[model samples]
Target: MKNCIIIGVAGGSGSGKTTVAKNLVKAFKSEDAVLVAQDAYYKELKEMSVQERAGVNFDHPNSIEFELLKKDLETLLKNQIIERPIYDFKTHSRKEETITIHPSKIIIVEGILLFAVPEIRDIFDVKIFVDTDADEMLLRRIERDIHERGRTFESVRDQYLKTVKPMYLEFCEPSKRYADIIIPRGGENKIAVNMVIAKLKRYLQKGAL
Candidate 1:
C-alpha cells in the first residue's frame, strides 16, 4: 500500500479552508481521498450544561482532543479503520454513534490549530495555511454559526471578541510559519488547490501516495 499522504489545512474560522480541502479531494483520482475536520474532535462536554458549554472557549487550541486525533491518523496510515467521534454542536455533547473512517491514500485534515500542536504537525506530510481577511472571516463565521451550528449572534460576537480573535492571533496565525504552503483566498483560488493536486500526484508516483 502507498503511504497515506496526510495534509493539514489550518486557518482562521470561516477562511474557507474546508471548502478548499473538499475541492482538492474531488480533484483526486482515487476514491480513497478523505477530508476530516478538526471540529469533529472537539472534547466531549457531557458533564456541562448546554449554556455552560456554550461559554467554553472552543476557539482555544486546548479545546480539541488532539491525542485521539493523532492516534486515529496513525491507525489510518497503517491501513486500519477507526471510529471518529460524533459531536453535537446544538447540545454541546458527543453522540454515541461514531463515523467509521477507512484507510485512505490521502487524508486532508482541516482545522484552526492543526499545526499549533507540534505532535500533530509532525504527522502531516504537507501543511497548508488558508489566509483571509479578519472582517470577512468574522462575518462568514457569524452567518454559519447561527444557521448551521445553532449559535446565537450575541454569543458568536462575544466568543469572537473574547476568544476567537485572540486565539487566532496567538495560536493559529503564528502556526502559519509551519506550513509548507500558504493559500490566500482559500477555495476560490483554484490555482492553489491545483498546485496541491499536482504535488500529491507527483508524490503518489514516487511511491508515497
Candidate 2:
C-alpha cells in the first residue's frame, strides 16, 4: 500500500454517493481498489429496544462509529488487513460477523456525513460531494427504503421529514465546502466520474515518480 490514496465520497442519503463509489471501484478493478462504506460503521444499538432504535436519529454524525472507521482506514493505509463491521439495516444493529478487508492502493470511503468531521475529512486525498436536487434525493430515498431496507412508505416519509432532511441541511450540505470536486446529477454524470478516474490515475502515476 505504498502511496495509497484515500478518496472520500460524501453526499445526502440517496444522492448517489454509493453509485459514484461503485463506478470508481469498477474502473479501478477489485484488485487495485477497496470500497469502505460509512453506513457499515453505524454505532451498535444493543442496549436499545427495537422501538427505541427505530426512533434514533441515524442521520446525525454522532450515530457513526467514526473512531473505528478511522482506525480501519489507518490500518489499510499501512498496508495491513482490517476486519470491517457488518451492519444489519433491518435490525438497526451490527451483526456478530465481520468481513476481512485487505489493503489496496486505492480506498474509496463512501458516506453521507464523511466530510462533516475534520478527523475523517483530513485523511482523504480526494473529497467528492455528489449534488442532486433535494426533491429527487427524497424520492430516491423513499424508493430505496421501501424496496431494499424493508421500510414502509409511511415510515420512510416520516423519518425523512423528522431527521433526514434537517440533518442533511445542518451537517451534510455544509460539508460541501470541503469537497475538492462536486458532481452534479450524481451517478448519471459519466463525464464527472471519468474525470475522477483520470485524476486518480494521475495521482497513482505521480506516486510512481
TM-scores vs. true structure, each candidate = 0.95, 0.97
Off by over 4 Å in 1: none
Write down the lDDT of every candidate, Cα atoms only.
Answer: 0.89, 0.94
Worst 10 residues of 1 by lDDT: 27-36
> Each candidate: how many clashes?
0, 0
Give the poorly placed runs of model 2, Cα more than 4 Å off: none
Report the poorest 10 consecutive residues by lDDT, candidate 2.
Answer: 200-209
- Model 1 earns a TM-score of 0.95
Question: Residue 91 CA error for candidate 2 (Å)?
Answer: 0.5
Please write out the lDDT profile of model 1 over residues 5-60, one tens digit for every residue.
Answer: 88999999999898988888888765658878898899988788888998899889
Candidate 2 per-residue lDDT over residues 57-87, each given as its tens digit: 9999999999999999999998999999999
Q: State in Å the error of residue 151, model 2.
A: 0.4
Q: How accurate is candidate 2 locally (lDDT)?
A: 0.94
